[model samples]
Target: MTNKQLQVLKQQHALLAQFIIRLSLFYQGYSKAIDEELQTLRGHLGSNANFTLAHVSINKLNALLQEDGGVLRRFKTDTLQSVEGAAKALLATSGKANANTSIIDTISQARRPAESLYDVTQLCVQTITLYSQVTDTLPKPVGVAVKSHSNEPLQAPATLLMALQEELVQLLDTYQKRLPDNTELTILKQKVVEGLNNDELLNVCLTLLRLIVKDSMQEAIISGKVIQSLHHSLSSLHQGLNKSIDQAHCTFAVQQDDNLAMRKELIKLENDVARSDSFSALKTQTQQQLKQVGSALEKREENDRLAQQALSGQLEALKAQVAELESKTRYYRNRLAKQVATSQTDPLTKLPNRQAYNEHLRKLLDNRNINEQSLCLAVVDIDHFKSINDRFGHSAGDKTLQVIGKQLSKALDDNDFIARWGGEEFVLILPGLNAKSLKQKLERLRTRLTELPFKFKQDRLTITASFGGTCFSHGEDPDAVFERADSLLYQAKRAGRNCVVTDKDDV
Candidate 1:
């Protein structure tokens, strides 16, 4: 390949990396919104059952409409109207209720489709735009002879661009077709179409760095803004989700309180009836009154049971939502790692950039809890990293790090996590492990590293890594534990580098 073609390929690779990062971030937001929505739907379903019981009381009140010349008709009508109004109120507050029931069937069903669409769209857009930018930046023809001899075709860039556009168009069309026919869907589709045709299109065009030479950077210039627009659209979804959940919670609480109040009132009414003494020849009337009250109590008890069942179902649904959210979060994390590696990671070694390591450490500290089980942290640093880098250049340095990361990861159990801590440095987290076991594991890992020979450019390079480990031991704070491990790592470095060190006090 000519220098120009190589340059174009590099530019394309960079764009692709950026696209992936943006797509992953967007999907993360979408997933979170869906989770929140699912939780809200569950809450709404619980509230609906509670309100249904209230409607039953209203139905009983409506029965009085048949009383002749009793002025009951108006009261009954008013009660029915109140029930209708309440149903409408419930529907209005729960966004999921507004969706076509046939399409989603349940709140849980509705959430998945919408969330999946969002993620798919984000990913597709990122992929295509990156591809387009890369193609557009192909080095100028140099000379016709050079271009022809280099096996570069004249129409490849245009063909690739058209293919990308077609892909995006198809994705959007498929998404729209899947949405249930509704005003919301219509509005969403219109917004998406407008974004694609206007600012988003312009941004895609500008991203082609070659367009800069033609004074047409409009697409690249607006790409960031288009991304922001997409972000705003997603943000609106979360707001709607939050409102639904809030309303559901409020309705449930109110229904519970009302049920208790009704029970108390029924008891008071029964006591009043029992204490009365004005029924000389009205024994039958008193008996009838007692039967009616008993029936009402029984109905109330049944309603309470139904309401409780609904609430329990809602809680289970919320748990499912939380689980879904966790899964989505995992996906986002993996996507982020891929994106970061493409851009900032040592391509050969596939190790975390310095920035990523710092972020990882912060996350570890933030997520740690006092009551959590024992946590073992190990820091491993290569013994002679600089010598390898000097002898074989940066490429060999990368391969060494990648091999080390792979070995370390393979040596640890599934519960353990290993990440590139920094240049030639690695960190591992082993949960539910005590200090002694952690030490033994580290020693074994060290031994394995000593035994292995890393191959690069037809030469075998032997390497050793020093390990320092400390355990949280049930009650210790994360910061203190990390500090101890770090100090031990320094100790290992001092004690001839290829060894494992633990806190002396613990030993």
Candidate 2:
């Protein structure tokens, strides 16, 4: 070999070895086996490296790369399967949809061992968008906007999912209030509001569904009873009508018989008079016939009077039956009304519940002249409430809630509204209050809560709460206003509880 060619070959070998070491370092921590192989390859290429050693390490790295490629292929397959499964679940829950039928068909017809993940990914994205559009059309809760004061960015899917959850929670609250109070229902609703994850949320929703079914069944039973009562009343009315009809027919036949007998007596009298030769005989026959006619007429009058009395008795009975049925109907109707009111009422605090709050907020937002009116919303969370519950019994906690609810209600104006949002939280809607007024009002309430004399198990304690409030700006989103207010409330929470945070000046 020529000296210059040999020197060029050595330089090329040195460059190749350096490249191999760099490549091995790049593959570090991919897998334990891969890492170990790279480590050994690095050692072989270190300080005292030669052409044969470089060849061996390069071959080993190439084999490891191939193995990693297979793993990547498997990962891709698993991810596609997961996506397909998610798509199926969406279809199952959403029911049949004609708009996405082709997409669905493509997914269903795809081979078990997917040929292309890219195609699957595209289809999945389209399906998800379809579902998103449908969900977006659902009625969103009033005062739920998606602006957060956090560093973490909120993705569209996550935000939509949260909106759906809020809607669901609101729906459950509505149902819970309109029905009767239940322990299980209350617990599930609280968990849902407190932000249970999606998997746990599904389980909670199922439980809530069962409760709703139970309530529906109860309502059905009540309706069935009402129907049965109506049916029985109608049957009685029918029987009364039939009996009156038969009585009328019997009276009619008796009257006809009496008339016929009276006619025959008169005719016999006339024939006897014609046959009589002496005037005295005629007079006697006439007298006897006239007496018989009088007796028949009297009997007919008595029969008619008795028949009238019998009819009067039947009518009275029917009237009593109708009155009783009316009274029962009225009673049940009133009971149902009471139940509806009860459903909207929080049993613990005897205040309007979250369902009531939702309705109230909706009305305010929907008002035609809402822009002119000053509307303010606030959230009050009792500081260290869980601690109270943990230390004292639930009864104490219940009492504490009741006292605070009443005090807060009393502290507000009559036109203002207050409700038990859930647990140890309360919501207030103060109309005709501007930002400055809102801040002052909230501060006053915060102080008032601390002043409340609370005693639990012979231990005197002072209770306090944190407040977050925001006023609705003209043409601003009601939900955005609410979100801003809620964010402030948490800020208050973070700033040592028992304080008021508001977007009064900012708004």
Candidate 3:
């Protein structure tokens, strides 16, 4: 080919390499960002049943993301190789006689890598959808601020915290606030010191309590040990991988030196052939020398090509090894994340715990457009729940709680939010509802609960509840709204239990 055309091909090759490098960088950066977000999300998601659902979803998305990263890397490597191969093949041509076929063949050969790049990009886009599903599967759990999470263990300000605890106990005493019996009170105090510092922490602690009793915590603990072993396994595999790459580089360097020597020998032979006299004056020995040199040159080229193929095979094997290690790493990581998700759900009822309920309530109130969007909050308590627990058994009480939770969920609209708000109390967040409608809905739910022949171990019974609800007013604290509803619930109890009471009540 002409000097101008070869120069143009080299320029194109360089430009292609630069573009491929940039694209690879972009994919890697974007992937890293997605991974970081998922990790942060996992932290916020905490632990629970809903989190289990979310964890599985997160892993699926993460696997897709990891696959996309691998594909993008492969596509970049193949594209650069294709561009280099096409440039070299074109530059090696003796003349322009077969330029069109050469160009067409090169383009045809490169098309697969281009298509691969497109497919990988498409797969990356699908990851965005998987990510959205992950968000939907659980949503950010209530009250737990993952933003405050730290690798460092929390060191509660001991002296100050103690004084604060004493002050709180005294304050409760001054108000004549009722508390559990001394044995239960001691347990509660220990829980406080062991750091149920706030309502949210108590919710998380209680949620985990159910899991521990049911031995899910034992399984998670075993899983934790397995994670450690897997971590070691990944580290060992990574070490082996680095060794393989280093050894391959050593072999490649030696091959490169040998190839350089062969090139020098071929160049010297070409110069000797060129210096030969005119055809009529050419000697027989000279012709023999030229023939031998040409054969030797062809053999050297073949050797160089074989070396490259060997090196390529080694590099591909290394890539596969790295990918496998990463897959295992992600697997272990996701399993651990599942445990974290486990902590965020109520163990017995498998509902979002109180912390999650609080967040849901806050979100409803915060997202409300005061003029257009009305919201309602309700607190439902099973009437005489203690009497049932005392008469039947704690197991029966648990069964009752579980049954009521499920019944409440099934009875509510798909858009309505419900959660176990500690004990036999259920909290509801209903958006786009006025006080009248909200009361009606709660009454319907209460009626459904009444009809439920709650069965535990072949013993069937019916139970009822009292509900107090209020409309969410703009510029009001969500806590105040709930307090008002709770007060109305107390009023309902005074009027006689198993009733729905709302602000509309003239009482």
Candidate number of the best lDDT: 2
Better of 1 and 2 by lDDT: 2
TM-score for candidate 1, please give it: 0.34
Model 2: residues with Cα > 4 Å off, grouped in runs: 1-212, 249-278, 358-378, 384-397, 413-416, 429-441, 455-462, 466-504
How far out, in Å, is residue 37 in model 3?
Answer: 33
Instruction: Give Cα-based local distance difference scores for all models.
Output: 0.54, 0.73, 0.61
TM-score, every prediction: 0.34, 0.50, 0.48
Off by over 4 Å in 1: 1-348, 351-371, 456-459, 473-479, 505-507
Write candidate 2's Cα lDDT for 209-230 as tens digits.
Answer: 5665455546655666777888
Q: Model 1 Cα displacement at 33 (Å)?
A: 34
Q: Please, what are the lDDT tens digits per residue for candidate 1 over residues 263-315? A: 76567656756876766534655566567667766776776687667656666
| lDDT order of candidates, top first | 2, 3, 1
The CA lDDT at 200 in model 2 is 72
- The TM-score-based order of candidates, best leading, equals 2, 3, 1
RMSD of each: 27.4, 29.1, 27.2
Q: What lDDT score goes with residue 428 in model 1?
A: 81
- Indicate whether candidate 2 or candidate 3 has the larger TM-score: 2
